[model samples]
Target: MATDSAAWICAALLAFLPLSTARAAPLAPGQPAPDFALRDQHGQVQRLADQRGHWVVLYFYPKDDTPGCTREACRFRDDLHALLALGAVVLGVSLDDSDSHARFAAKHQLPFPLLADPGGNTARAYASLWSLGPIKFAKRRSFLIDPAGRLARIYRKVAPDRHSQEIIADLRALQQGHAPRP
Candidate 1:
């Protein structure tokens, strides 16, 4: 009876607690990047397994068309060719639905995929989701997945203005057989 009462109390307390926790620890470098299947702005299903043999830039942003998100996305747009030349594919993920992504991608002329994670499962897998009661959004984070589908680096603190450039430089270094300083 005592143990049952304690368990009941704990469950009741948990129900009353604020729902602000992320899913799990962020994946470490060298771990195989989590596999995800999500529909992009065009309703095309994209899978991480398909991106093998090319560097994958998997970036998670908070919303569609917001200022910081725009800046980060446009920078990637401007540098897309360079990144492609270096065998990289950029993927942007957010909690927005496909309709929102279509508008945002059209408005910004983004050439890459902006994946819809309306349920935030992908963001949660990446340890990038933030929740407050009923509200949730992805934090600004990026994962650099190598050609073998392993995480090369994880950017927990991102500066939107120079993030693409930073990735470009890092890709160059990694391709040249040196550890990226950034």
Candidate 2:
């Protein structure tokens, strides 16, 4: 009888292994961002080190052409000027292929580049890998990388509607030498 109980407990514990493996923590603020070179929507190569002197907004989404993702891209489109003025460049990252990214960008008229993290290399590097059951893509996350290639802030719980405005505010504050709000 004791052996049966032990076997059941072991089976239960083994069943939960997949769940524990699925959840991953995102990158912490103040850590040096992992550098990567991925192709943009146009197949143009983009590397983190290339934009060393400019602030980089590295945003990773689940897929392209989705409602929330579209809204987030549009918000960034409308706020591009403000962000550029604050000396920041926005780069959207996703697991989508280059063709999908191009179509999404053209459809939405996004002003910034949409990078393709085909193997989710950049996503994993930034700690954005999504592992909930069958979902293998990265979660919708945003990282604010400073000019020196260090993560200044991370927007884990993104508000797709207000994402652009919130990022602009954070950039403005950071540029003015103020700590971003929690």
TM-score of each: 0.89, 0.85
Residue-level error in angstroms, candidate 1, position 137: 0.2
What RMSD, rounded to one decimal, does every model reach?
7.2, 5.8
- Prediction 2 global C-alpha lDDT: 0.86
Model 2 Cα displacement at 85 (Å)? Answer: 0.6
Poorly placed runs, candidate 2 (over 4 Å): 1-26, 132-134
Among all windows of 10 consecutive residues in model 1, the one with the lowest summed lDDT is 17-26
Encode model 1's per-residue lDDT on 1-182: one tens digit a residue: 99999999988877886777587765898998999999999999999999999999999999999999999999999999999999999999999999999999999999999999999999999999999768899999999999999999899999999999999999999999999985
Worst 10 residues of 2 by lDDT: 17-26
lDDT tens string, model 2, 1-182?
A: 99999999988876775542233345688888888888998999999999999999999888899999999888899989989999999999998899999999999898789999877667877777766444568678899999999999999899999988998888888989999899
Q: Once superposed on the true structure, which residue ranges of model 1 sit more than 4 Å away at CA? A: 1-19
